[model samples]
Target chain A: MTPDPAAASAPGVLVTGAAEEEVLAAVVVALRRLCAGGAELHLRAPPVLDASVADRAGYSTSFPHLLGAVSRGGAATDLVLTPAACYHVYPLFEGRVLAAPAEVSVLADCHRQEATTERGRLRSFRMFETVRLGGAEDCLAWRDDRLDRLGHWMEALGLPAERRPANDPFWGRPGRLLASAQRADRLKWELSADVADGVRQAVVSVNHHKEHFGAAFGIRTADGEPAHTACLGVGLERLLLALHHAHGPTQERWPTHVRDALGLTRSCTN
Target chain B: MTPDPAAASAPGVLVTGAAEEEVLAAVVVALRRLCAGGAELHLRAPPVLDASVADRAGYSTSFPHLLGAVSRGGAATDLVLTPAACYHVYPLFEGRVLAAPAEVSVLADCHRQEATTERGRLRSFRMFETVRLGGAEDCLAWRDDRLDRLGHWMEALGLPAERRPANDPFWGRPGRLLASAQRADRLKWELSADVADGVRQAVVSVNHHKEHFGAAFGIRTADGEPAHTACLGVGLERLLLALHHAHGPTQERWPTHVRDALGLTRSCTN
Candidate 1:
């Protein structure tokens, strides 16, 4: 990713004010427009999920370092903070056989405990994702299509983001081999952008999960085969910071097309 | 709170689907219109909050039973899932003097470890709140005004909810004293509605905090007096359940005005 000096001073995480809300609203609208294929949209989902569901999703085994467990009054509970928005989607389709491909779009506040407090690497952040479930070839093709569409969307917003092959930050010794295999198969591709001064980060990730979640959740296709899944996930806060970097901190001064794309027109009246 | 037989079988905690998304979006639009007064709107807030902030807010002492603590890999962390939406707003104004009263509205997913698994008393739920910070008199009057307006809104939606004096389920002996004091001061009023079969719940809470949060967060008015705070909070899923009870389960068969109010017209296209 190309370095941009303007994003060097971009505010990391926006937790207050109307501008942040406006930007998020705009992002939702844009995502809906981009994923307009009879998609089921969910505006909110619980931050915590059932531990059994997490275990079935292989979250702890794959990335144990990132899991956040929830307890009541210092006593352990059967819940963990959601690591990804798509995890919630998989449970909804569990034990069902899809007649055709299923499309789901959700915006959820996801949590992961990161070892580093670096910019754009927030422990708590919002994720806007469009998930597709179908055959393996269909899922991979959908992932590629989303990558191109998301890349164009970034360009439209005046941000220079590069799409590159990537892998999950898996845990333990076995995780190293898993990460290498994932890269060899090119299961993940990230749209990297300069969110801060010389700080390049992945703002969007498109991943293809080949029969992993479906096999775990007992979801199947009409052909008696485990369904494949793919997700195009956008990190909302990181995207906002990238916008701030490319368009400057002030919304009023940003290009008209960019503002229109993000629906950032300042309303005089509430 | 009047009983409604239709709501007896209403589903609780809708985590997925297009209808759930539509209802939430409608609730947000209605809230924005109701809270139209140059309010700062936040669509999201982290489910977990800093332990120190929760302590300063007196949440642990007041409602210890409802708090959910966060841990990473069995090790405790200094974080707790937010119990209410208003707690996040107070810390934003810490040690600051407001020139005028500040109005903020937020929609956040709140977690409260309720002892019961009854309908409408969810462990995890969405809260849409409009908060006000100003002088004591202003806060009290705002609370009353909100109570009246929200009552009308409920009536317009064809729901038979009663506005009654209430108190938080404070914990222990000291909490008992605080609850009694709050009740004596008439600081809290709830719009109680029958969300299910014989399940009377507080669908909305209008609270007047006379310098409590202000003192805790060190927020002051221009005249140097600690600011008073008030919040009008609506439980989204409970309200939806109440609506279902009042109008039946089928959205297509509901009254046109009610459908219009909720923006629940089933779109033919995505």
Candidate 2:
């Protein structure tokens, strides 16, 4: 359910899927359309597994430990391009926080059950009230937070998001905090309803857990919630795989839009 | 010219190089030495250039049509990896056949010229050869064309090379040919003495290129006409760079063997 480019005129869809084959298939279809529409394409590096986790996986048998540990044992475990940082958003819980209003009733019902009776227990969570945006901005500064700016950016682009208080699972609870904000940062923008519709369709076929094993989950958008609360994750390696599938394996045929998005066009020799 | 690894075995020097910074640096010092021996390291990647001539440049912004381009119009170009064919070992020239002796001589001289040329010129030349080694039994039947057993296995390993002579300027000549081969269709290997020393050093760098390039170049040892003839190379992205340099922009510490050979292990990782 990819959004129609004609309706939203959004930059091409950036998808992160479970397997290389699945993502590659989607990229091929997107590339065919983009080529026909004269859009540029770019491929970003794939999302890698956390380095610490890779070391624990014992991936050194097939390849040299120095090489195999870094190359495999992660999300974007291919042997082509170098690894780059891309933020994977996840809810960070500290204490207790509000649930989306729509989930209140359901959550209340679940909370009423005894811990031993329920399949899962309800837990209290806390999140940063605001997040930072751009360079060097602190998370407390709402003005600089992408979540706050997303509405305006979408509106400026003629794709206004419905504003409403909602829970941000990412940064809303205690999980893993990224070492550097840049590696955890992403550009958050509103998806047009038309585009959202397409995303919903595509999401049906995509396995939510496949993108980022324990970090990624889906949120239901209620009738009055933001048009859609999507975290535009930037998995560097996943992006590369997508691009490889969209365009040919060669970098020459990459779409211009994608190249520009990643700033790969900046001349750098191998 | 490449230093003889077998001769330097007691001192056991492995020289390697690549067209990448991290890879070159990483190859010199890995976290662990899979194979124990001292290695002399020479790290070199083609420098980034805006423009250059067809024969001497290593990189370019335009789609190079001649002299085996590495970058095509700002995109990295794919080098063809050929399988070890009988024709590669004995090249045909002007209705005459040049046996192993002539083939080896032609390749050696070409390598020397390419190595002595300006750095830019060396970059422009796409001189490489590859060979696939499987189980001892499979390697024995490599000469049989009917059963592409080795070639098929290499392709299965993700390297898809053809069992024919390459069509590069270095190998396309009537009397001259570049002896390039690969273990898998994707695992590209070359036989050259020009940057053989640099190549061998790169393997020891523990850099990313060791795996990314999977390139190993060497000259036959039976009749070493060229004094400094034997060398091996790996890729720039496949080596482990973290082990070679310290926590700065420069290399701070190289491995003990590399330190002794290059006399600079205390460099930064910059």
Candidate 3:
């Protein structure tokens, strides 16, 4: 997502802007550094996905009420607004077996029909995601490493957020059990920061799918066994909000290291 | 709209990425330079719009078949996916008289349910828009200046494009007449680029709305007269596509000025 340049220097309400660009650019640089040229970075994707694909991916079961349908010709088509970035990526590698760990970094526009109009909790938001697919041990290692990388990096930027137990927004009743299982297995962790509203917001998450996507999409390892997968997702807008709250409204007030990385010098947010 | 970084350097159908970032950044720089510290820059906006707002803005009538509705609890809410960046802006100043020429730049994700799977077109796309609201003369000058500025800058970057009389996508049969009127009156001008498909696609558009928005939204100019407005919208995806088609695949092959402007030095696309 391109940050709004006009609001770049100010703590104005516009989510991502030029002032936040340096931060986002630094994150991208970090992702690239982590990739070390070993992972493929992907930014190209459509906003909507095939309904059958989302259904098969368990979106309907997980977020049935949240699904945003794309109507075509006065009727709902087979297409659906993408609920999560990873949902689209897994289907792309359906029926494929990886000889080695394959990694990708992608930015996706995630859409959801929410009942709440809470600040920083938007129906449509951007997600910067890094995904790894391979054997279980390797995937777990990558996920854990990401937890460290993200936590440390946030602290370094002075937006010290904590990685805490997290849960997915699954559907009506059974979702309660699935969510419990998720937290029990420690499948998810959130990087949370206190915003101006005095509420801690989860701006980033690390998730280990443990062959969930692999089994559904038939993505296999070299041994022809279901692969394991892990994903790190950064809610870009929320992160920008947290940063604005932490670093005042102007980019000039940010640390020189942060500005140096983003290569941003002009300070008009005054 | 951010491009997948994997496909960023290479034009492999992903809309936004590292390459797009450089161009988008350059655009932001240009907007700031043009604003010259007087214009108020805005970056925060949600991806969706209220249905009633869209209705008052004439979207429900013009793009009746194209509205993307958000259904919750088995009923359609007042929310509709935004169709254009400017639609939401006009209502913000409804019934308010500007003290002077008010200028603003905004980036919005526009959603359109297109039937074509054509290249360079999608269901949802990003739009970077610069708008001016003032008296008729000032508004026209601002719009014309935008034409000159945009044309000169694109040429400076070596992405030479032509400006052609254009028309909006009005609704059904009667829309043909309305579109013809729009073109006849020179209400819109398009910046077109010749892509790999041997077809010219409009990457940007300059529009002059002489009190249409003001009258509809009750926006007023100084002295309490209906305000005249103009908008310059750059379709970031289409522009990026044009850049790829013009400069060829890899960033390394790009001109030195273009590369320098974007601060792009990496060349893994080889």
Candidate 4:
């Protein structure tokens, strides 16, 4: 079945790499393709060492300055990539994009057994709920960073963009704490008609969380405050599934769009 | 750090595929490798008809027939592989061991977004809970059909092999349900010690889902229960951070295990 045109055009792909190697491989391939096509790439790297390192080295430093070294190059960079053990940390690298070699690759390896457990799931669920409700602004702040980045990319490309606060219904409504809590974090963007093409062609990366199941895109209707936005996820396997769905398995016969996105040239045999 | 020798010897790997093509690609490659070594393979495939067709053919009729086809291959087949989506309909496929094509692979394309999501970190947690509740036994039973086939291969090869219930604590406990009630509609698997080595050596066919977060595997303890498992997930961009962590991006070398697993045989030329 055809996906909703809106979703198809504004597709959001979700990719998972089984291991660190696979994740990097997919990202590296994507970066190479994007950069090679002259698409501006953004890189964000949050320092692993804390300010204590500066004290040890006899260097007094501000967090911004320390982070600046990591975030420099902004739009000049071809990819914005960072390591975040926790999702909350992702926003710290916001506003700063770095430049690196097209071939440069990062590897984040985590063991599932190590990271997840029944207890862990429960803790995460609790933490997620708590932070989401108690720290609504913080959550909005994280989301803002991403939305702002999209704005930045648009500006860099000289595309017309517009930012408008959505008239979200749940923004100030009271009843359920979760409902009131959700309003604490909300942001929306509407690109100018001129950049509609760019927005249509653009792909937004969404980091998955359980909360995402409820609100994947964070978009809400003017009156339908809780009406979550539609997100287009690219299931690593499902993408292949889509490929098979649209085209056959043979790489030679893959859709031109997919091939181009993946930077896969037709093999002579194909 | 070196993984535990016992763990390494009995390493468990989970490979997710996107579509049947990608799944087949990964399986074929893995099978070729194992076939050359004359190794035995076990597999399990749950019955999953196309959604459109599922309604017409009740699951009872569909599942057994599918299982029968897989069992018909008997001991000659060295590896086992199956569609993960089947698990959604047939939760019983979890604990059972099956004779696969000498290699096992699952399509992980659907999990790309899930892997990278905040919830992705909870994969192990999900596995632990799923197994602990004995919810995976039915899935295991489904898988056992194929394991029985593999047993035939072992018997024919004069290889000492036996199938016994795993005693992993994670798979033995019963617990209150967590996550959304809808999760009950999805399929689940528990790891078994007997299946760990095959999983590790097996090449997982990933799409974007599994690639986004990391790779996940199921593990079984001595009591035939799925205890602890691991998912080697690295955010695509996080890898670069990790590289910086281990050694500066320039003139760097990853840990031996990391390098070996990724098949990164060469130094960074760029």
Predicted model with the maximum TM-score: 1
The predicted structure with the larger TM-score, 3 or 4, is 3
Task: Flag the better candidate by DockQ, 3 or 4.
Answer: 3
Model 2 chain B, poorest ten-residue lDDT window? B103-112
Report the lDDT tens digits of candidate 4 across residue range A1-270: 111211210011111112322322343345333322321212211212122322222222211111111111111111111112122121222222222111111111111101222211110000000012112233344444445554554344233345543321221223244333433333333333221222221122222122331232232223333222111111122223323333453655645554544445423110
Candidate 1 lDDT over A1-270, as tens digits, reads 111212211122235455666777778877878864657444456677777778989998898899988888778787788789877778778787988888888777888888776778888788988889899988998899989988998998999799899999999999999999999999999999998898888999999989999999888999989999999899988998898888897787889989877766634221
- Name model 4 segments beyond 4 Å from true: A1-28, A31-87, A91-252, A255-258, A266-270, B1-104, B107-166, B170-262, B266-270
Candidate 3 chain A lDDT trough over 10 residues, lowest sum: A6-15
1 or 4, greater by DockQ: 1
User: When only chain A is evaluated, what TM-score does every model earn?
Assistant: 0.92, 0.24, 0.87, 0.27
Per-residue lDDT tens digits for candidate 1, residues B223-243, read 999999999999988998898
Docking class of 1: acceptable
Candidate 1 CA-lDDT value: 0.79
| Per-prediction DockQ | 0.31, 0.03, 0.31, 0.02
TM-score of each: 0.90, 0.23, 0.85, 0.28
Query: After superposing candidate 3, which stretches have Cα over 4 Å from the reference?
Result: A1-17, A20-38, A44-46, A72-74, A254-270, B1-17, B20-24, B27-38, B42-44, B157-160, B257-270
Lowest lDDT 10-residue stretch of candidate 1 chain A: A1-10
